[model samples]
Target: MAPAHRDLADIIITDELAKRASEPPDYLREKLAFRDLADDMADNPKAVLPRLVRLAMEACGAESAGISLLEHEVREFRWFGLHGALAAFEGTRTPLDYSPCGVTLQQNAPVLMKHPETVYGWIRSAGISIPEVLLVPLHLRRPAEDGGAGTLWVVGSEPGFFSLEHVRVLTELAAFSSVAIRMIQAEEVVQAALQEQEQLTREMSHRIKNLLAITDGMLRLTARTATTKEELVAKMSGRFLALANANQLVRRPFAHDTISRVGLQQLMETILKPYERVSTKGLDVALGDHAINSMALVFHELATNAAKYGALSRDEGQVSVGWSIHDDRLEVTWNESGGPRVCQPETRGFGSTLIETTVRRHNGTIRYSWLDDGLTAAIILPLSSLAR
Candidate 1:
């Protein structure tokens, strides 16, 4: 289960993938074959490797050919693409420790082994024979001398069936396979980015529509509650500005930083601390990795209402926030005291609607109690949404 690396230090991988000192066999024919495959790759990158493996077989005159990529995660070499005799075994895997492909990588050059099946039991178990297999290290992310990747291999039907000419052909093919793998990987990355951008555009459009609806609701509430036209104008202007600021903070990073999540304590500071007269305790428990935008706006509305009508409205009033962990949920309480006598509003404002909408979006529950001293809002969010 070790690399056949005895005296492997004697070999130089620096120029192994380069063209041979002498001309390759059937130079014009091989050139035509590779040029055709290059065009095919531009059309369908996913199919390029298989076609390249077929070309490796034809140019090297091997019975079977394949490309085995090292899956370092699982410590195995997977037959990524193949052609000829062992095509049925495509997608199969062999232990990296025991694979000829691994030896080729460690050697950092083409490895020709005669009757290797006797040493590798897995090959014998597959009910196929590898009398002679020429494996060339594939230079993927780095050259073979530094950190090679996969292997481009060709198998002959009998011992002494391969030669130096076969090795030259396969080494070039191995270089080509490396390029193909990177091209395919690059295409996949570009595609994923495009899809993410499209999703973000759609999401932004939907949020804008929701914000408009919330704005409309706020306008109706402000008109109903404003005592004078001048008062209405002042309140409307401030409220519109606050909404704009909250919208800016609520925007989430959609790139690699999407893994980040915010907690209620941080959310409160981000949206409430600017107005002051608010404090918190016992909010150190773990939180669900919910979307911070909705919860952020929720706190924004709540704090706005408090400054206008709740504890924060009076200099003597105080608001305390705290939370506790339950079996499968977190219960957070926002308690206010020392303001005007607590009483439920006769009509619900857009602020209340906004709070309810945001809480529900994260599968959380919220309730408001109009106690004798002040208003207490208790919200519970499911712990199941934890990132872990």
Candidate 2:
């Protein structure tokens, strides 16, 4: 007799499982429309979930309705949002293996329990008299491989208070809840991407403004060094062009930081390229990315002076720039020849002062020799300043 009764019970449970697995006609139609409202709810889960719980309570005529999200790692269901009599239970946790919501999730259907305390003894121990509870599995719109979301439920204090009508209403709410949870997760990803883009925009803007300011300062200093209008324009134009080229090198795609190392050969070639009339040669050398603007400015001043009165001013003139690392120092030589006679300036000007300042800033030294044919300048920088 006992085996017969157990066999009959097993058959009843199988039939129940089959019924739960099948979707109701109304639910199928309702789920089709969930996609349209998903985007709207994605951005505002706090506002949407509360209203959803409220609507669920009103639609089902239940005393309480709430959404519980499964925290898989902790094996618990966390009450994300709630409405009606159980509103105070928000943020509370219940074991996934022991709660009514857990049973509904496991069965992948609506679980209607009479005297839930009979199974979840804590409900009785806590003195919370919830006699009847209805939970609907809130399956997320995730791929079937992900096992979907958790459960949403409506509980009442009176026995036999909930019916099939309540299940229908809660199922609809559960569908909506699943989409809402997915939307919230997507919204977070979108928000994070937007924040990163905003930060990059601000960083680029600041870098551009800083480059412009530096160019302006260079223009003013160039003005102080020129003896005539032609010299002023020429000097300013060369310095500006050099500054522009340096800015271009540092503005490579997705460069987040301000400081970038300019290669020694690359830097010299870029600065000298505009001097079309002069011949320029560069030798490869290792240089770190530090004080790039200052170093560029120093080379710009030297190149400008060459174009005006040194090697670059004459058709037969030529300039050779090279650097080598020696005993923890970087030695850069700028040798010029095949031009008109060279003479040292009588007074210290912006170009000379700028060169001095740049060298000092990098803890380096520069020496200029005004030869009979052209000027030769040698700059020595500490290896520490040139180490990447």
Candidate 3:
């Protein structure tokens, strides 16, 4: 019976039906039709694609039309901008491994399949009858093989429905769709980059403010307690070194530079190391490897202020830290005793700001009391956030 098909490299005439039903496409109408797509592409790129699907259907005089883009991450060809008989199946996800759209992209040309449902189980399962489908590849990404190719296709109303002219019109539309989609993707990338920059700005402002405050407080405390210029310089150097160590310990997550994990107990001990001694109670909590760097800053500021002017500055002064978990909340208490008569500062310093901000970031709260003998501070934080 010979081969029941007559085919070319990019064109396939499966049967005599395609020849019997030929009507050369109108070039003038094709030219006029692209105007709307161009206007939409310029005015609103997002709006152009659905119009493209509708235009492809209208221009080709097909029963249904849609666009399928290859998502390399999931290795799937997701259907978008559907129209006509199969419009209800919008947002359908088909595996890239076994799809005609994938084949069109792989072939890097237009593909005309006769009765595709006979071969593709998904099409048969979808329960829509397609006599023929004319697909044109959209090279959304260059080289196509690196996985950024897609397809714009129209389902024919009857067999042998597409001709060379139909292929030409669809091909032009597919090219235009490729440009519009690339523009849309570029705009999305810009938006995402802008959002990340905004977040980074906020974080930087907070860090700068806190760092200045910590340095200011340390200078004042070191100057007040230093017996001589040499002693003051030595004390300030030691304190600054300790602060750097604390910051470096928790810096990885912020810089996105490297990964490191420090336990809750370890962070507290390191930050409080500059002070003579800080007795830690209930410091054993398994919050896993996701450590909060902000907590390290809080403890450093607290212990720094203590060394400069609080209970830790005095010979007989003492500081004890204890924590308790109640339901979903963790409460930490800081008690100072055996020091000089204590009075709260008239102005709030950066240390206080750092403490309040860190607590608030975790949806937590902190309070301080100036007792006749010493300073007492209480912090309450969400255990869920801490554990995470």
Q: Which stretches of candidate 1 lie over 4 Å from their true place?
A: 1-24, 72-75, 141-146, 228-230, 237-246, 249-261, 281-298, 313-316, 325-330, 338-373, 380-388
**Candidate 1 lDDT trough over 10 residues, lowest sum:** 5-14
Q: Estimate each model's TM-score.
A: 0.78, 0.48, 0.64
Q: State the C-alpha lDDT per candidate.
A: 0.74, 0.70, 0.75
Residue-by-residue lDDT tens digits, candidate 3, 253-329 = 43342334456677677777657757988756544222345676677667777777888888888999899888878
lDDT of 2 by residue, 1-388 (tens): 1121122123222223224433334555445445434544755674677777776776666788888888889988888778888778788888988777777776776776655654456665665656566787876654355553677777776654666666777777787777677777778777777776786688668766867777677678877766899988876776677777766666433333333456767777777677765444444554543455667788888887888888889888988777777897888888889878988888888888878987887899999999988999999988787653
In model 2, the runs with Cα more than 4 Å from the true position are 1-193, 201-209, 212-216, 225-231, 252-262, 276-290, 326-329, 382-388
**What tens digits encode model 1's per-residue C-alpha lDDT throughout 17-132?**
24435335898887898898799789888899988998888887789999998887888889967788999999999888887888888778788776565567777677776667
Q: In candidate 3, which residue ranges exceed 4 Å CA deviation?
A: 1-22, 144-148, 244-388
Q: Which candidate is the best by TM-score?
A: 1
Order of all candidates by TM-score, from best down to worst?
A: 1, 3, 2
Candidate 2 vs 3: which has more lDDT: 3
